[model samples]
Target chain A: MASLHSAVLDLRRLELMANGDSTIHRLDARAKVLVTLVFIICVVSYTRYELAALFPFFIFPVVMVSLTGIPPLFIIGKLALLCPFVLAMGLFNPVFDREILVQLGTLGISGGWISFASILTRSILTVGTAFILVGTTGFTAVCRALERLGMPQVFAVQLLFLYRYIFVLTEESGRASRARELRSCGKKGLGIRSFGSMTGHLLLRTWQRAERVHMAMLARGFSGEFRTHHVSRFGWAEITFITVWSGLLIFMRIFNIPHLLGALLAGSIS
Target chain B: MSHHIVQVKGLRHIYPDGTIALQEVSFLIHHGESVAIIGANGAGKSTLLQHLNGYLTPTAGDINIGDFPLTRATLPDIRRTVGMVFQDPDDQLFMPTVFDDVAFGPLNLGLSGSILEQRVEECLSRVGAAHLRDKPPYHLSGGEKKRVAIATVLAMSPDILVMDEPTSGLDPHARRQLLALLKDFSHTKIFTSHDLDMVFELCERTIILHEGLVKADGPTREIFNNADLLAECCLEKPFSMQNCAACGRPKTGL
Candidate 1:
């Protein structure tokens, strides 16, 4: 119960960062969304053994965090929450293939180890850029941007509703859990034995709540469509923001800056 | 003929699971009059409110809002006539910011550009929530959320306003402020609440529902003054009325 309460609060804190007044935060949401999408695409498009190339992608999130005045700890904390999934995804890579790729000092680095590093680095970069996008632009603006970018109205509305109700659902579950805890008196409550019934109860409650919410929407003239009043224009600043970010991302993808710098430094010293 | 702004005739709502939620419930609300529906939990208060705007279809009954009958085709117009403020403001204020939530109904009605903005502003100012226009609904305090929820409905410019437990979870100061705001509105108002004090202040007529039936209906003063009837319906008289009776003072004007 305590963790659930704090989790809800932490989510709110992360979203509150978008309220800051800064250059990055003030940028058009559409531009931020498009740039973040492009960044993720470029980072993930790298080859399996392209660990060094993926390092440069970290600049996007770092610059966004600094420019938007969002706390680095907050972004990293969110990243940590997601790290387990990414780690699980690449955990088998180190055992699948054992082709020796190169020699670093006395250790022989295998292709599997290189690819594993690449996957982890890529996951961090992509996820970090996404975190920065949401932190700087806020979820509402992101939905509006998606709607304006020709995504279906229903999908955009679903995203908005899902984001809005997550808190409500969390609080409901937290309260229910608290009630169970109060009655269970330090016994093994909320265990596997009770999990099924608890989930079923939660589902029923959420369904009823959804019905009430739908009725409320219908009462106010909602006729099967979710209409938004946010009017986003693709002006010069938005265009420039998208173009500069995309151009840089494509440049970084095409040319391996880390490899080039390493070779240049080696040649210069010799 | 008198203007019956809202008329519910023999309204019977049966749940899908064979539960009779509302049985033979009938009522008429005149224009510009405030009515309160008071009942314990599961008294079909919410089910009845849902029927008013055509959200829930009656199993066997009729609801006429203004000139439009409650049907599939007239749902839009009926909803436009009856703006509902939900019990939990969070459920109503689903939009990201207060302004958007306020503007939702108007936008759905196809009012756009400056006209939509003007309506939102007017409603927000009317509810004293203009300063909360840009704040997200989640960021608002409970009282502010309730006010914004009212503003969201008021922005549609409905002729009749129906609310469910408008003062359910408010502090005394917030409750008093809400009562004052509701009192200032000139539209036809219908609400369901457990707050008898609010009913005394804001509603001229009160309807008590018990076990899916209208146990009593009359002027608010007469109904609250009847302790026996209230007790039968599992309701206590308003504290003010009880105090008056204890002091042996005459019932004064509200």
Candidate 2:
């Protein structure tokens, strides 16, 4: 229960970070959103053997984190929580494919190892770019950007509502858990027997709450759609931001900057 | 004759599972009158409030708000006419920022640009929440959230305001502030609350509900002064009345 409470608090802290007036935060949400999308597409478009090429892609998220004053450790910590799933997805690769692809001094590297590394890199870059997007633009602004970019209004509203109610749901469940703990004494009273009923009660409460919310929405003249004051205009700065970032992303995608830099360094050393 | 801004007749609501939430409830609220509905839990105050905005179609009765009948065709006008402030501020303030939430209703009415911004700003300032314009609803304090919730409804310029448990879960200071704010609103107000003191302070009339029925309804003073009726409805006397009784002062009629 305590950990759940802190997790919600951490989410709130991340949102508060978006309220800062840093350069990255000041960039229009449309710009940040478009750039992040381009960055992700470029990162994921890399071939399996192109691990070195993915390293320079890290610059987008790193620069975002630094410029926005979002803590590197916090973003890394969030990524760490998701690492197990990414690791699991690629863990069996080395055993499945044993074809040697390259030699590293005295050791042979297989295609499986290279692909596995590529998967990990892709996950990090994509997830990191997503975090930077949210950290810099905030969730609401991102939703507005999505709507402006021609995403369906219903989807944008659904995303906003989901984010809004997640806290309410978490708090309700936390209170329920606390009540259970207080009465259970030694945790003996709460087992699978009670868990089903507890979850059932939670669902019932959520349904009733949702109904009330719908009533509130109806009272406010919410017909079939949601209306907001968020009118995002694509100004020159936003266009410039998108143009510069997309061009850079395309250039990075076409030519492997890490491989080129490595070759140049190797040549200069020789 | 005083015009009835809201009229509900033979109102009954049955849940899909067959639980009778409300039955045979009827009431008339006149223009510019402030009324408070008091009841125990499950007394169907919330169900009755939902009917006013045509959110919950009464299983057996009719509701008329101003000239609009509570029906599918008139739902939009009914909603616009009767602004509802929900018990939970979280549910009401669904938008990301205070400004957006306040502007939601007005924007739906097709107000745009400076006019929309001005309406939102006016409501926020009316509730003393203009400072929180840019803040997300989740970031607000409980009292601030309540104020913003009221602003969200007020921006619509409704003829009648319905609030469910407006003062629930609020601290004494917040409750006092809310009471002060509610006092300033000129709209025909209908509120459901367990706060008898607030009822005594703000409402001129009171309706008590029990077992899904209109158990009693009258002037607030008369309702609160009737100790026997209060006991029957599972309600306590307002704190001030109890304090007056404690001091051996005879209860005086207002």
> Residue-wise lDDT of candidate 1 within B56-161, one digit each (tens)?
8899989888877888897888788888998998788766568878888898899989999999999999989899987878889999999999998888888899
Tens-digit lDDT track for model 2 on A1-270?
787787777776776677678766777788888888889888888787778888877778887777788999998988887789988999999989899998999899999999999999899889978877887777878887888789998899889778867776787789888888889997668577889999999888877777667777778887666554545466887888888878988998998887888899999999
**For candidate 1, what is the recovered fraction of reference interface contacts?**
0.78
TM per candidate, chain B = 0.94, 0.94
Per-residue lDDT, model 1, residue B128, is 93
Cα lDDT, model 1, residue B17: 100
Residue-by-residue lDDT tens digits, candidate 1, A24-114? 7777788888898898889888789888888887888887877888889987887787788988988888899799998989999999989
Those runs of model 2 whose alpha carbons end farther than 4 Å from true positions after fitting are A16-28, A186-188, A266-270, B1-4, B111-114, B243-254
Report the CAPRI category for model 1. medium
Would you list the C-alpha lDDT of every candidate in the order shown? 0.84, 0.84
DockQ of 2: 0.62
Q: List the residue pairs that clash in candidate 1.
A: none
